[model samples]
Target: MKDSWRRLAERLGGRLAFQAPLRELTSFRVGGPARMLARPEDVGELQELLASARRERLPFIMLGGGSNLLFDDAGFDGLVIKLGAGFAGLEGAGSLVRAGAAAASADLLAWTVARDLGGLEGLAGLPGTVGGAVAGNAGAGPEGLGRAVTRLFVLEGDGRARSIPAADLNFAYRRLEGLPERAVILEAEFALTSRPAVEIRARLAEIRERRGGQPLGGRSAGCVFKNPPSISAGRLIDECGFKGQRVGGARVSEVHANFILAENGATASDILALIDRVRQGVLARRGLALELELKVLGPGGEVRA
Candidate 1:
């Protein structure tokens, strides 16, 4: 497998690293290493790499900005493809804006706000990449990223690129459903309303202030669990007295109960254990089962709770 990856690296001629550390890549800051990490320069290279991986029968996973993910302590034994800077372009034509998959959410927000785009003001302080936001349907309150997405350009599992319109998509809470298995989002077009830049900035400021209560600079994923129905997960966890609860080096944030922070010397196991304890406590006390918002990646590239 190492030789196969080496050959693939030579053929692609992009940034490919063996035994790349996964800990530094994620916001959680608690993960092992990846067997192989590849950053493709462009869409053509990405397509070729994916096709080659498939043909070689190698397991592969796509990583965005790594804001909402938790990789296992044992690490991934497969290919980890992260889109390069070439896939981070952003452009605008009137009220419609197009952003590459790897473009940072902060950058996209800034671009739209500068152009007086009103719709994305709700996503002001969101982390991760555009592709991750679109895939997870990231949002602030009732407004989701999918609401602004008009069309998406994706590289399918079969190596075919397709343009999918919003009408054909199924945008649910905290997730974008009905995408083809292994489909990779290349770029997305968002339709936004025209507004004064000052007004947009004001809205953004308001959101930032509201988000000030969260542990912004902490070593943690944004949220640990999704709100159930009309209830807030943080409120429930707080009521359950899980705040400041510690499991090894992972502790529930004192500022926000929904976030589990990783302190120095934290491991993936510590975080996972804390998450389980909090979930059980919430369920036992509140009688409501909270769903996880954090994506836990196992050693085999499978998604865990």
Candidate 2:
């Protein structure tokens, strides 16, 4: 299987590396490695690569900026494809901003805000790539990234390109419900309100202030669990006295109960174990089982508990 993949990688590009360490790529910095890592130069290349993988019955996963991801220490056994160069631009005019999926969310938001756009202020202080944000429908307060999406250009699971309008999608909490699973977002167009640049900056400043307690610069996936309908996950964890809890090199952030920090030598197992403990504690004490917002990918493409 390794030999077969090596030959295919050669046809695609040599930049594809084997046994690539994923720890440094993630905000958590605790994953082991990817068996075969591939970066597509453009959408065409990505399409061809996917077609080949499907033909070979080789499973492949899309990896964005790796901010909201957690991989097992045993490492992924399938191909990992990361979009590059071609998917790294943000451009539009008037009240519409089009951003490539691989574009950094912060850069894209900053670009729109600088141009006096108002709708994206809700996502100003979040991390990860535009694709990751869109896939997860990440948001703050009552606003989600899906609300501003006007259209999406994506590569469907069967390697067909599609242009879908936001009205056709189900914009729910932390998910784009109607979109097909494994659809690769190439670019997205966001509808924004035209406002004074000063006003947008002020709103962004307010958001930053609100996220001040998030342990922004730490090596941890931001906000580990999704907020339940009744109360916030952080508040529940804090109420359960889960803050400052440490399991090996992983520690629940004292500043924010939802964040689990990974020290230099921390393993993915440590983080996974800590997450289970938090969930168990929350369920046992509050009778409420919190769902995870973060994507936990295991070795065989399964989800870890």
Alpha-carbon deviation at 268 in model 2, angstroms = 0.8
Candidate 2 global TM-score: 0.96
| Cα displacement (Å) at residue 234, model 1 | 0.4
Off by over 4 Å in 1: 2-4, 12-14
Clashes of 1: 0
lDDT of each: 0.89, 0.86
Candidate 2 per-residue lDDT, tens place, 1-305, comes to 55656676787667588888888788998887888788887877787777767877777788888988999998888778888867989998888889999998999888987787888887888888899899888877745888999999999978999999998887777867777777888999999999999888888898889899799888998888988998989999999999999889999999999999998788989998999999999999999988988899989787643
Name the Cα RMSD for model 2. Answer: 1.5
lDDT of 1 by residue, 123-238 (tens): 78888999999999998875588988999999998889999999999889888986888999999999999998888888888988989999998899988999898788998999
Compared with the true structure, the alpha-carbon lDDT of candidate 2 equals 0.86
For candidate 1, the per-residue lDDT at 122 reads 65
Clashing pairs in 1: none
